[model samples]
Target chain A: MAVIQRSRADKTGIVIRYVVLAVGALLFLLPFYLLVRNGLATEQDITSPSWKLFPSSLQWSNIAELFNNPAVPMLRSLINSLVIAVVQTVGVLVISGLAGYGLARIPFRYANAVFYFIVATLLIPAAVTFVPSFVLVSSLGWVSTLRGLIIPGLFQAFATFLFRQYFLNFPRELEEAAALDGTAYWGTFWRIVVPNSKGFIAAIATITFIGSWNAFLWPLVIAPDQSAWTVQIALSTFLTAQTIDLPQLFIAATIAILPLVVMFVFLQRWIVAGVERSGISE
Target chain B: MSTVTTRLRGRHDRNLWFLIFVGPFVLGLVVFVYIPILWSIWLSFFDAHNTVTPANFVGLGNYVDMLADSAFRSSLITFVVFALFIVPTTFVASLGLALLVNRARFAKTFFRSVFFLPTACSYVVASLIWKLSIFSGVRFGLMNTVLGWFGIEPIAWLSVTQPPWYWLVIVTARMWLQAGFYMILFLAGLQRIAPSLYEAAAIDGATGWKVLRFLTLPQLRATSTAVLLLLLINAFQAFDEFYNLLSSSGQYPPYARPPLVYLYYAALGQGQDFGHGSAGAVILTLLIALVALGQGRFLGLGRRED
Candidate 1:
């Protein structure tokens, strides 16, 4: 009878634990709900800011109106952001992956020295290089194109270091067996290492995409005209101290932020795993 | 002689293949990173102009002028103040959010996504939302509208430098954009905390608040340092949101004239003085390095952990 009573108490404690958790989760979710409701409202709704937790009317015109804004050029901006993020991710993955493989799989003198040198650059803040990089970008005649932005960020010091660590954890027996089978090392890399490292690749892809999307300093400096501006640059349209387009701007931001949020949601475990693996060896 | 030649050929082939394997990264770094850094250091000493002309050495004049400049000094102060508020506020808020999300039962993923949405936001986009939706002083902006319910009059949010309400706008902007990213980091740290510790605390007659203080904070120490240093560095590196929020005209000193903004005004916005820009860049670099190194020491980065 006492055991039965203790079990009931334990179940009650579990229910109480959930209640505490639910309230806390609500606090975390409030701002995002505020953003979504605000985004769907009309221009008039933006001006008459009542404390309506949900939108009174689903004024879907804001999205089209945003598309219609001449000064903004929405479609072009989306293309630019997508192309830059995609292309940069591809280039970064390929380069960093190859470098990682070489350090991990290859037996070469001075390999450790080279790896450390690349990793050391991670501590040097990007801001330090901002001014000079701008001048250098212009000197190379890459000032106005997506190419300028894409090329500069194509390989990161940390990404190379990250890939190296991931590759080191892979088993070497497969590579040895491939070598003994009279297979070339490059073929083995393509068939085995590249296919096997999808999780790390996804992790890098998420980091790079979000990073490219949010990148401000270089994009602001390099993109010569409004036509070439990334989505991030286009989203800066709500800039009045006295009066501003609240609903439209919020909607645009929510849309802009959606891709990364979705990616993170689907691959949450990979990211958690990635964070654990990164820089711990140093 | 043929045997020796074959051996030499074999060694050459292996070295060549090794280079090809690592070529992409090595080549990219040399072209993009190494060259840029060396050129940046070189250009810091030269009076560079747009025209392809002979660059003249300006010696230490640029650095000298930067030290004398009031705007440079103000910008540094502005950044320091920003870091002071943002680092602690974001860290605590994220930890709180992580604890909240960690305990959630129903639709936990959905709740995590909602919390993380703002962080994924592009800074310029987020800043635009803040500008239009929230602080519009016409009594119609969301924040002002909410304040109206409390009988508070609509006041200038970012324009007036008095009591630095303008500064407050920047801080809030940073806080909203940053909170979610750190929450994820804290969540990762929280996952590492043994469940047994929480159970032990509950059994020891510790209150919820005490359990949090004793259990969570100690466990999250490394993550706390990471968050603090990252926030401190990022706060000083504030460019996008600050620029988009303040610089509508792209030519003037944006808003109340932060140091980077002021430096941008001098270098790119008006005088087109790359020399002055270099000076500003060097000083900011030195300041950031000093702080980062100090934090590294505080974190005991050099000491090997067991």
Candidate 2:
């Protein structure tokens, strides 16, 4: 905690810190730089014997071509993914937020029981249910539809657990104050409880949105048809082939992930703070 | 829930709310998860020919036969080997990266963000990067393109696993995707360590290795345990990349795909061999349970429920 240390100790620590950080940063940045560079470069650059991270001339057409590639509906897929991601995020936040409040604040009997049951479900892998989920979606005629995609993800026990953890640490007097003003449980939940949970809600929503956006297996299983596919499903179809163009897949891969990365930048600092704090005692 | 005053001796309709919050997931699980799982189990014991006709039960014969199959043994071994290499290496690399980022005085957010960029990428995107650039198995591939500097001929990276090069492909893809995620977890753990601990170490002349060894390592036991368990779980769930990358041609390296991919191929890729696929699924569930139990025992994960 001292601002000043022995000159020798200070010198050694600074060198050690910067050198390790530079190497670590490079390890993280290289792959991403390659992915983005590959997407922007021309076929000649990609196929060239000599590698260059910087390109001679920017080929800006890859983005246009990526969207226009009728083989994949890039714009529509984005719209589809956006609609699904937003709606699912909102729905899950409300449901899990309320559930989290009830579990953490209400202190009712079977609160722990309900919590344990939901948490147990977390350990069950989706692959085990692959067949039946497919059959159920198909049976309900919801397969290959956005409804099918959005509904299943709306319920997340981990999200509930997250909100509950934050709620437990919250000072209880806010709810008590609202109650003294004649606020009902539901009224207090919507007003005082939710507004106060802005940071936690944002963290939960970001996590849920990312999960929904990156989802592949369920989307692939339920909507294999190109017309109904999310961009993730569409990008994966490039793989079910004899020979794949590496650059094109790189372009598509970049396209599929760019939006989420943008969203992540806005929320990473807060989410990391929240998730780390949650893990402090867990 | 009713007011605590009247509700002190009474129960809120707790299951109703639990159902509202967890109902969707549970309903989805039962309709989607439980039924399929139980069906798979029941179907595994039957000669279910992907037909509408009734499946005739054949007792434990399917389990008996799968246990004797060499392909089953090899795929199981492949999963185990992949886990062994990927888990410890990824954990160490991620934790090391976390410490570096944590200690850096400048641009900590930028470094953390860059480190985590890959984790947000979809598996298909990541897999395609490996497939087209590095594992293209052609002269144009990146690895070969790079090796051209040394005057070595193009080597087919994906197919030529006389050295099990497919494992390399799998590991490379995994490291790129996972290292950032575990880095976040480690950074989180790093923040929780009290500054006093480090200061105490400093007073004892524990500035570098001595401080790290005495302070950081001992303080990180639980986090390390969680990391180990999570890494193992993630490794065990290796489907997205393997499924996407497994070469349709015979160019696939020997023992390239894991049990899940093989199960997918069996159930859907080939003619419906649900019985075999179901058996594989059963084996996977059991394997996951066993591993969880082992880790729980080793880490004492839930022992001190504060």
Candidate 3:
């Protein structure tokens, strides 16, 4: 009888857990559902007093309307954003990877000093240097240029720190075997370390790409011209316009988020692992 | 003699290789980060406006003016209130989500992914959605629509300050955007706790809240401290959402102005006072450093758990 009572209680507990989780899931997903629903709705459907979860008919043309809208320059902004994110990701990977490997493996006289200096840079908030960096970039005539967008952001101290921590645990035997085979340090790194570190590299690449793609403040300040605007900047333009077309704005937002959502769906494992590593690595 | 010389040459080569590997990154950091920081400090001492290069020297004038300015002072208070509310709120939410998701027996990954999906969305997109659709003042807005079912009148969410319903919009938007990321952090911390401790607790007749208080929360100290520090810093650095949500027609409302937004107006926006902005930036930087140091000491960060 006691065994049956315990089993019954366990069943109820499981049911309660499922019920709570279902409610939470719906709450989390509501905004995303609304995003798609409104994106395909007519302006009347959006602003109508009587709310409906779905529009009478889906307006797929809202996507075209957003793209063709002259003021937003959506196509140009999208292209710029793509170029910037790719370049910045590649740049951060190469620069931070080299520095991280050296700091981890090389027993040079000033290795600790160099590592500490780089780590100290992490504590200096970006806000302190925002104005001066802008001034410096503008003085170099880099305003509205891709170089302006990509070059200054290439050296990320946090990425370097993460890479160093990762490499410190890497098997020295692999590199030692390469050294014994007469591979130069550079060759050994490129040929052995880089190939073996693909997982970590992918993790960092996803993070850097997402960060650069979502970056708003620096791009907002650096690329003031409409021609040089990133997709984020382009999105902001809609809000500041004299009138906001609700459907078109929703369509644009949906477009802006689509790539990231796809990337998350595909690469979420690496993204989660990378974020976990960052939290606990210290 | 030849053997000794070869050994020395090898040592020299190793040093050279180190420099080669690390040189470009260190150089970039110096040029981009260090120089910019020093230049900002130097600029703070001068009356720089509309130009990067300034000749008019005013020692401590900008700093004094920034400290005295009502708007600048108020922005600091805004940061304090924001941090006070958001840090604890996000901490609890993230911890709660982590506990739930961790305890889930079925479709664990599904629930985790659903909660974390919003982290991939940009602050800009989230702000736009919050400002326009969810919190829109009209009766048709999602919040208002739900309220109508209960016979409550449609409230102008963002504009009104007396009740400060805008805080609801701002805080909820940020919570949705960020809570998931921190949940992942807490999940990691939870995973690191050894299962033996839980078994021991169960043997001791401890279950539910007792096990949580005695075994779980204490073990999560390091993660909790790190999360709090990160949340505080991020709160201090808030600009994108506030600027996007509150600002209309290139003008930001004075009520919700954080330091970064205020500085943007002073330097980059209409005011164009770079000196004052730099001074404010320096002050904010120092404040952050002080807080980080104090928090680290208080929490015994990086100390060995065992």
Candidate 4:
């Protein structure tokens, strides 16, 4: 009798767990559902007193309309964001990867000093640097240019720290073999180390790409011109406009989010693993 | 003699490779980060109004003005209130989610993805969705629509400051965006706890809440410390959502202004008071460093054993 009672309680607990998780999942996904529902709705549907979860008919033309909107510069901003994210990702990977590997593997006199310097910079919050960096960039005539957006962000201290931590655990045997075969450190890094570190590289790449893609403040400061505006900047402009076309704004937001969402879906494992590694590494 | 020469050559080559690899990064950091920081400090002592270049020598004047300004002080207070509310709220929400997701048996991956998908969305987009749709001040807005069903009048969520319903909008938006990422961290921490610990607890007749309280919570100390530190820093750096959610027609309302937004206006906006802004920036940085130090010491962070 006691065994049966325990089994019954266990069954009830499992049922309760599923019920709670399902409710939480619904709450989490509701905004995404609303985003799509409103994006495909007409302005009438959006602002109507009587709310409906779905529009009367799907307005697929919202995508085309967003792209063709002249004042918003959606296409240009999208291209700019793409270019910035891609270049920044590649640049960070190469520069931080090299620095990380060097700090980990090279038995140089100042390696510890260099590593500590980079780590110390990580503690200095970006809030302190914002105004001065902008002034410096403006002085260099980089304002409203890709150089302004891309160059300053390339030297990421956190990324370098992460890379160094990753490389510290990297097996020395592979590099030793390459060294024996007359491959210098640079050659060994490119030929042997990098090829084997694909998982780590992919993880960092996903993070850096998402970060660059979603970046708002620095881009907002540096790229005020319409031509240099990233997608995020373009999306924000809708909020401050004299009149907001709710559907167009939602559609533009959808477009801005679609790339990262797609990327996240594809690289979810690496991103999750990368985030886990970062948290534990600290 | 030949062997010694080869050893010397190897050392020389290794040093060269080290410089070759690390040189560009160091140069970039110095040019972009270090130099600008020193320049900011220098500018703080001068009257650098409407220009990046230094003007009259005003030793400590800018710092004094920033400290005396009520608006700047309120901004600091605003951050404290925000951190107090958000840090604990997110900590609980994320820990709750992590506990739930960790215990989930069926479709664990699906639940994890659903919770984490919002992290990929930008703050601007999330703020837009919050301000314009879910928390929109109209009867037809999502929250208002739900409220109508229960006979509550539609509230102008963002504009009104008396009840500060805008806090609900701002905090909820941020919570949705960030809670999942921290959940992932907590999940990792949970996974790292040895299974034998739980078995041992069970053998001691500790079940359910007791096990969680005694075993799980204590085990997650390091993760919790790291998460809180990160959340605190991120709170201090709050700009994108607050700026996007509150500002209208290129003007931010004075209420709900965090230090960064206030400094943005003071320096980069119409005022163009770089000296004052730099002084405020230095003060804020010091405050953050102090908080981090206090938190680290209190928590005994960086002690070797987990």
Candidate that would win on lDDT: 4
Candidate 1 per-residue C-alpha lDDT over A1-282 given as tens digits, one digit per residue, 9 for 90 to 100: 987997888778668766765675575455566678778986666555465566669978888887887755677878898999999888888888888788776766767677666765665677667676777777888887877879989868777777776677787787777656555657778987788878878877777777887887788778858777887776664452334566666777777777877877787666555544441333
TM-score of each: 0.87, 0.89, 0.96, 0.97
The candidate with the higher TM-score, 2 or 4, is: 4
Model 3, span A108-209: residue lDDT tens:
998888877887777777755788889889889998988999999998988888888888888989998987667767888899999999999988998899
What is the TM-score of each candidate's chain B when compared with the real chain B?
A: 0.86, 0.88, 0.94, 0.94
Local accuracy of candidate 1 as per-residue lDDT tens digits, B190-219: 888898988898789785579878888998
| Better DockQ candidate (1, 2) | 2
- RMSD of candidates 1 onward, in order: 4.3, 3.7, 2.6, 2.4
Consecutive 10-residue window with the lowest summed lDDT within model 4 chain B? B297-306
Per-candidate clashes come to 1, 1, 0, 0
Please give the range of 10 consecutive residues that has the lowest summed lDDT in model 1 chain A.
A273-282
List runs of model 3 lying over 4 Å from the truth: A1-7, B1-9, B297-306
Tens digit of per-residue lDDT, candidate 2, span B120-188:
888887777787766667787778877787988887776675656777887888898888887888887
Question: What TM-score would chain A of each candidate receive against the reference chain A?
Answer: 0.88, 0.88, 0.96, 0.97
Better of 3 and 4 by TM-score: 4
Candidate ranking (lDDT, best to worst): 4, 3, 2, 1
lDDT of 4: 0.88
Q: Compare the candidates by TM-score and give the number of the best one.
A: 4
Q: What's the distance in Å from true for residue A126, model 1?
A: 1.5
Q: What are the runs in model 4 whose C-alpha is more than 4 Å off?
A: B1-9, B297-306
What's the CA error at residue A199 for candidate 3, in Å? Answer: 1.2
The C-alpha stretches of model 2 lying farther than 4 A from their native spots are: A1-13, A243-247, A274-281, B1-29, B51-53, B248-254, B297-306
True contacts kept of 4: 0.68
- B187: Cα error in model 2, Å: 1.5
